[model samples]
Target: MITHIQGRLVEKNPTDVVIDCNGVGYLLNISLHTFSQIPDEESLKLFAYLIVREDSHTLYGFSSVAEREIFKLLISVNGIGASTARTMLSSITPQQVKEAIAHEDVALIQSIKGIGAKTAARVILDLKDKVLKVYDLDENEVSVNKNNTNKDEALSALEVLGFSKKQSERVLDKLLSEQPDANVETLIKDALKKL
Candidate 1:
């Protein structure tokens, strides 16, 4: 089991990298997030997950153990494959993936390209509990999930008060990201000031 690779970075691209360990050069598939996280140094280390099929062996690399763990969870779903899991990791940060599942934010999950409504819902359904348990996330922390409700209410109120839904949602997303525990009233107040 090749758990990790530490070697000279022979080549790098948005979707893959080649690392020269000793005299052997190994190519590992990677997500954009991992590609960005990789430092510009000769000596680099990446945690790896190996997928072996009857026809070929593929190696995927992650910048962190957390990202790799999420990839495993994502691929465990009935319809999600390694490529789909990599796409999910590339589309959003690992923390965002965990929060989305824990909070049941189907829209956020569906926002990724190639992910439809059903697949997004399935991701949340299949991994929500596992994510919660593995990450030790209690309601108090994912209170950000609560923010989704509060944020929706705040957006609705703003729309009724003549603000554009698109603009209101943009401002609300920023506000919620900054203050995850803010209530609907607070979100409205802050968003109103910003808008």
Candidate 2:
């Protein structure tokens, strides 16, 4: 039930951070996006979801409300867990997640670690209508129409997996860059080689 924590950052790692709040130190699991934005020398206030199980308790923190909401929705799917949801979120922006569901792009979901084709299809089938209901498609939204936005999404997914953006862009550009016509599978294979 802990909604948030505000305190000095006592420690940090790839997946978690320790915050000193009123003399108590709280450990919170966070996404890389949150980690990249947090300043190492300053205190931080993070929105958190406290999860308790038979053997342990964990706190997951998010940098934005949209990300947290998306996480909640993701975990509500029948077979998805918090770790899967976190990995999905880490691999794509919240907006991209919403869009994938909206577009029913099972291949994009399957590109992430731990999601098989069947599970990815289930996710698309289960959440498609629901996600479209809440997503606000703006007129100026940068349409991810790189011939195959799904492959572009895979590149974005690699970036979320900790590859540098420059590297990802370069790879994607190389694979899809030169073509009167290039298929998604070919681009994906080429991109993976770059990785």
Candidate 3:
């Protein structure tokens, strides 16, 4: 297995990169997330995952080990292939993917291009526990940071009070952006005023 490659970045594109390691040039497939994370410098090092098939050997590269682990986890699903996994990674940040799975947000998962409702549900069902375990994610901490636990709690309370989820989310997002340190009571009160 090619764990990683450290060399000069000979070429760079959105979908792929070529690294010159000594005398050999290695081509690596990459996602947009990795492409954006790569630094514009002569020397670069990328964590790699090599896929070996009967007729082909492909190398996928990631800017971070976390992204690579997420990719591996995505491909472990029954219907998800390497390309699909790459597309998912390209479509969203690794943290978003993890949160969506942990929260069982089927609509969020299905919103990604090329993913259907069935596939999205399967992804959540198959990987929810694994994601929770691998990422050590607390269910309560899935969607909000400690500083914004109030925001999450308020959102749930609003939902239970029959507020539309989309409207509540927008209201919460705006409020959180403006006042990141707002407490639960303040968030809920502000959200109620907006709604």
Best by TM-score: 1
lDDT of 1 at 59: 99
List model 2 lDDT by residue over 11-91, tens digit each: 988788999999999998887767776777768988899788999898999878788888888888889989999888888
| Model 3 Cα lDDT, one tens digit per residue, 70-100 | 9999999999999999999999998889888
Ranking by lDDT: 1, 3, 2
Clashes (N, CA, C under 3 Å) per candidate: 0, 0, 0
For all the candidates, what are their Cα RMSDs to the real structure? 4.9, 7.1, 6.3
Candidate 1 lDDT, 135-175, residue by residue in tens: 99896776546667577678779989999978999999999
Q: On a 0 to 100 scale, what is the lDDT of residue 143 in model 3?
A: 53
Candidate achieving higher lDDT, 1 or 3: 1
lDDT of each: 0.91, 0.77, 0.89
Stretches off by above 4 angstroms in model 3 are: 142-195
Q: What is the lDDT, from 0 to 100, of the residue 38 in candidate 2?
A: 74
TM-score on alpha carbons, each prediction: 0.77, 0.69, 0.74
lDDT of 1: 0.91
Q: Residue 104: error of model 3 in Å? A: 1.1
